[model samples]
Target chain A: MGAHSLLPFTQDRDTAGFFEAAAEGRLVFKACLDCGHALHPPTDHCPRCGGWNTAWKDAKGTGRLHTWTTVMHQIHPDFPAPYTLVVVELDETPEVRLMGRLQGEPELREGMPMEVWFEPLGEGGPVLPQWKPVEA
Target chain B: MTATVIDDELAFAGRDKAAVVGIGQTAFSRDSGRSVLSLATEASLKAIADAGLTVDDIDGIVRCEQDNVRPYSLAAAIGAKNLHYWADTGPGGVAPCMMMGLAMGAVMTGQAKAVLAFRSLNGRSEMRLGGTGRHDAIEVVGGFGSYDEFYLPYGLQSAGQTFALMARRHMLEYGTTAEQLGAVAMACREHANQTPHAQMNGRPMSMDDYLASRMISTPLRMFDFCLESDGACAVVITSAERAKDLAKPPVLIRAVAGGAPQDHRPGMMFPVVSREDMTELGGRQAGAELWRRAGVGPEEMDLAQIYDCFTISVILQLEAYGFCGKGEGGPFAASGALRKGGQLPINTGGGHMSEGYVHGMNHIVQAVRQLRGEADMQIPDAELCMCTGGPLPIGSSVVFRKAA
Candidate 1:
């Protein structure tokens, strides 16, 4: 039997691109040629300027762990229960922020030190970068 | 004060006319055992039914939907004809206000006669529950997909953690306490105790219980958070002229507004005041605009259904809407002023905290019910009501009043 996620949710196919890159350990963003704001979840137009002049740019993945949650429930049908979800601030560019989960339980807190780890998938997918506790 | 929105006093006045007329909702639970589409249809149908109409009676549709719930499909399922007026609002909880805007536009320009607005989620199945660092990656949508990927390689994993940092920063800067956040939770529960459909029905919480609840992140305890519930909710909007014919009295949409400030260049724009950045001020401006357009004061509202996705959002909303000055939100919330029959009876239907989370549409439904004097814990002569998605960069709000 499949385990359940504590907090479950579903994204449309339109939002598949962002997840695709994160699995490969690449931080990709949508850059608008108009007002020049990097878009998230990959949109056709710049939400800031309403212009569709957009393209992709991958960031150097480095940012602070802004906030996070250890969901006691599953957000989707695919995951197991009570996983950690985090939103990280990318240091390479202020415009890009991403949310996912911590690799495994390893002591959590607010303003606690954190860093990224690109774990290679055993099932032949690209390497996946996840958040984990960082030592000082 | 960084742009036209900041200086626009016309948008900050306290009186406006957009009042809620009709309300509808489905039972909420951790497992509703229904597909997202089914739940959404049920809620939409109920709302239309409650408003004394058929699906065909509505000329427009608006929804805040995810993958399982599609806008066009919802329109088709609900049998809405000529659904030329439809909108898919996001960042969560703005679906109704977005629909309100669409309905208003239709009424103003003579494009549509009435509108139906809805929001839905199925956390039990056909859904991914939360955004956490545990997932290797997330699908990208309009904005979250494009720019949000930049931070994935780092440790930043979810919205809760992001807000946790905001909470810590606030605590560090202003001596805010976890108990203060607990007080907010208690206040929400105090209102929840009276509602029947609330998930935590009859569950009483104290500041100690809140502090003792499992810690999701420091400063954000288990009780400080809102539960993930599977459910759907809907609301109907019609011109005041047409509303007189409905089953429930018309609650006019006095004024409605929403915004996302431009400044939080990299993050979700937490620590709204600490950052003092230009972009993080949209919510405050939106609140100011609502008050200005509606022509009423915050104290004048009979009840409020402020979204409680988390206790922190409620605190921010209090500041954003001027329920209290910045930094005073903690104490203001602790005062139990939002309890039922208190200064501003909020979320009498338990809100997202005590009630199952149906995104934020349930707040709108409850607001309409309160205005109709039909709430499970009704406020006496509640002629006016206010509801919001609360603290989203792209969030929405509306005020309602009993019909003349």
Candidate 2:
């Protein structure tokens, strides 16, 4: 089963760009262009500065692992057991955090360098962003 | 962040104004094989009867948010003449205890003479909250708008994974161990062994058994999660003046307070990933205020019946409620202090982890039982108890005392 059947993706103005960029192997984030305050999940107004002048900026697709869990129980029909879910803090700002599947060993430690990559959304569906260990 | 010390004068406004005169519950099982409405009606009737009152005396009804059991249907079944005050509070686990505050407000304001606060869920037969196939996530209507987009995609669906993430962070920060989590499970199991109504009654748990349990999520094993019980619980809240003539001795509502983190938003607890300190829970945010309002500190509480949807919740509550300092929860839990006759007995009625999940309504029942000197594992001279609801970024808590 592909994610297209199980989960819905954003096509709206707020999140379409982030998903569209992910579809094209580019990672982007939302922020208040005025105060340079980073935002996540994209909103209409800046929570920090109350500015509606939000901007979608390119992200480096790299961050440090903050925390993660290895799910051993089957939590979804499309996704089987034993997948690593990670919460990563972007290298640019600690406030800008992202979460996704970690694509390697079940083992995890805090503060490990990680980089973002794209993967087909569950058996050749829409492309989605994933995290992996950054090699030396 | 500094904790808010509630203003003493303002905090005592609700003290001794209302009291819980009756507690009632249905059989906790994997399958109730009954409609949620029926369960709710049965529990409400029992609570009313326990308070030595009839449907006509029940002038108000309070429900937990998202409950399939509606006040209108419950009123119809109970033949309530007038529901002067009817309300619900949410998002689930935290709302049960908070319901008391609502009921108290209704009674104190003369909106109603007696209020029935209850929760009923066919958690195992009709639904499973801890499992993957939550209907709410699939329906995607109501309040779960953008919040679902963030965490549900990565197969991080269940409460186990979400709470495990919190446990993992606590472990990293305080060097907490899985064994400490095991101690919480073992303590509850020990209490369950004595609790006749406990779902896990007669079953014993050991440190080795806990460690051997299958890992549902990295840090949380199957034993760490609370049971998905098919049951209902209800309590009757009335003025202390009325409670003097009731069937059971009144368990005075010392105080009831609730709140969320500063940045808390509805649907924000899915992963709790963004906060700088994930260990800081909404319970901590509400704790200081709760105690100040109750006019009692943690030292005076004879026991605590914390919401134990997960073992980590009880641990987190201990730290947040000022029973122990931050980062000291693991050591405190593992120290045998929570066992009966220990320094601070907790979950003496087995809690949700062992007794049953009434969405925390059972915690209130257990608190009343303990204070009345009626619990199976009753602590001698137990006159004060604390009941907490959910350990999320936003939660509720109550302090109860034996009638003075």
Candidate 3:
């Protein structure tokens, strides 16, 4: 499948805000208003303190590379070969992590500093978060 | 001043309460040219016959939630009368042991007399699992409102890619090598060579072949992945008492445990990245409870059918299940401990790698075969066998002991 044929995001009650914020060039996650606990892929309630008060919060858009993989085989027609996928532990919440594509061919090492950027899908499609190596 | 609270007594009521009386499976192939329901029915009937029971004797049926064939459809096809219990378990490869656990619950509660557990799919011909095909597209990404929103857009879609990240990290931390991973593939292929019904039967694989295999994802070559075959496997579970009168020697279900760790995130199957330790599988927690309830340690196991969706999964599970210390799995595997004459013979039936990926149903079937002295790659006088489901969160493990 091509970039245009990418699976459409189902914006429901829980995920509408995350995608909305991504469209605005800001990476967002859920944080408990009660106990200030961070949640990824956001939940309605705080798992830590059992609090119902949770709201969307913008992240610092910077993180340390926790792990990575380079795809050499083509699974999708749109996504060509030899692209690296990375998981970055957010600077704001070390426990919370986000996954995105790494832009360039950089010699990757664990704990390498990285920053997030947004890329638009083909012509009015959803905006996606991507990553690049940032100097320590 | 401190207060202490004591928990309730540890009464494992399900311990040795149920037994696997029969096992059956269809041929492992790339294309069955038949419907999945047909495959399931064939396997279910064969298992029932193997148990010396007819379809009329079955009172319960359990299957994986991902299965295309439903219990009602299966019951109708088998002509089962008055089904008392029916349930489905799982996200994927973790369902088999969980299904057995549920069957044990049903029999213990007097809800069902005999329970049938089966998995059937046209994984290769119709719905290939190796790539981002229709099956994964609908179930994982589109159908379920999962956390795929984060990774799917970035083209991080397949399980191979997801697991490659774990394998790479494991190498960096423990100095694990591609050769060690190849050992796992070679061992399973060796076992499959002995198994007549294995998909890779008559086709041997060597370390050189494994190393030379094309890379699908870095640190993981084609040989590291499991096969995408079309097949079905089924087993019959009944009370220990009823098993005494069965056609075959019973392989008692000593114990079973299934769950994830505290840090397991929701929709974590795809993005297992957020866990406190990325290299650890759910086997650590589940294996602990399994040994506790079975009253047996890992050392007592004559053989193990560790889940092998990929070679890295086997390495991680060896550690998580306490076969070796943390970060020692690579060395342990490299030591030839997974081979037939080695320390703990694993995947004696070739497993998902060279056998066929019937999810994990084949693992349980192979475990029973080993205990019953019927396995093609039988461990001599095998007494106790351990079978693990997938290495992902919400995983499960089961211990089977030959009747004393």
Question: How many clashing pairs per prediction, in order?
Answer: 95, 0, 0
* lDDT per residue (tens digit) for residues B1-404 in model 3: 23434232333788888999999899989999999999999999999999999998999999999999999999999899878899999878999989989999999999999999999999999888877564233222432557777677777888898899899889989999999998899999999999999999899987888888998988799999999989999999999999999999999999998758657777747757887678987888898888888889999999999999999999999999899999999899999999999999999999999999999999999999999999998899999999999887667999999987
- Per-model lDDT: 0.65, 0.83, 0.87
Error of 2 at B25 (Å): 0.3
Q: For residues B1-404, what per-residue lDDT tens digits would candidate 2 score against the true structure?
A: 24557566766878988999988889999999999988988888898998899989998999988699889889998799878789989778989889989998999889989999999999988878876554432432112245556567666677778888888889998999999999999999999999998999999999999999998888889999999989999999999999999999899998999967655533546737776677778887688788878778998888888889988888888988899999998899899989997778888988888999888888898899888888888889999898898877587999998998
The candidate that achieves the highest TM-score relative to the unseen native structure: 3
For each model, chain A TM-score? 0.64, 0.87, 0.89
| Candidate 2 per-residue C-alpha lDDT over A1-136 given as tens digits, one digit per residue, 9 for 90 to 100 | 2343345455655667777788789988888988898776567687677788988888999999988888888766666667788888889887777777854346667999999988666554456677888987
Residue B150 Cα positional deviation in candidate 1, in Å, after optimal superposition: 2.7
- Candidate 3, number of clashes: 0
lDDT of 1 by residue, B1-404 (tens): 23554455544332232334556777888778878788889988888888888878777777774435776888888777767676666656555565676667666566666677788887544453446323424432223323333333233334565566566656655577777788778877877788878888899887778877887655577787787788888888777777776788777777787766544333343323223331134567667767777778688888888878778777777777778777777777777777865777777888878887877788888887877778888899998888886475555677777776
Please report how far candidate 2 places residue B29 from its true position, in Å: 0.3
Native contacts retained by model 3, as a fraction? 0.50
Q: How many clashes (backbone atoms < 3 Å, residues ≥3 apart in a chain or on different chains) does model 2 have?
A: 0
Sorted into a CAPRI-style docking class, model 3 comes out as medium
Candidate RMSDs in Å, in order, are 6.6, 2.8, 2.7
**lDDT score, candidate 2, position B50:** 88
- lDDT score at residue B372, model 1, on the 0-100 scale: 79
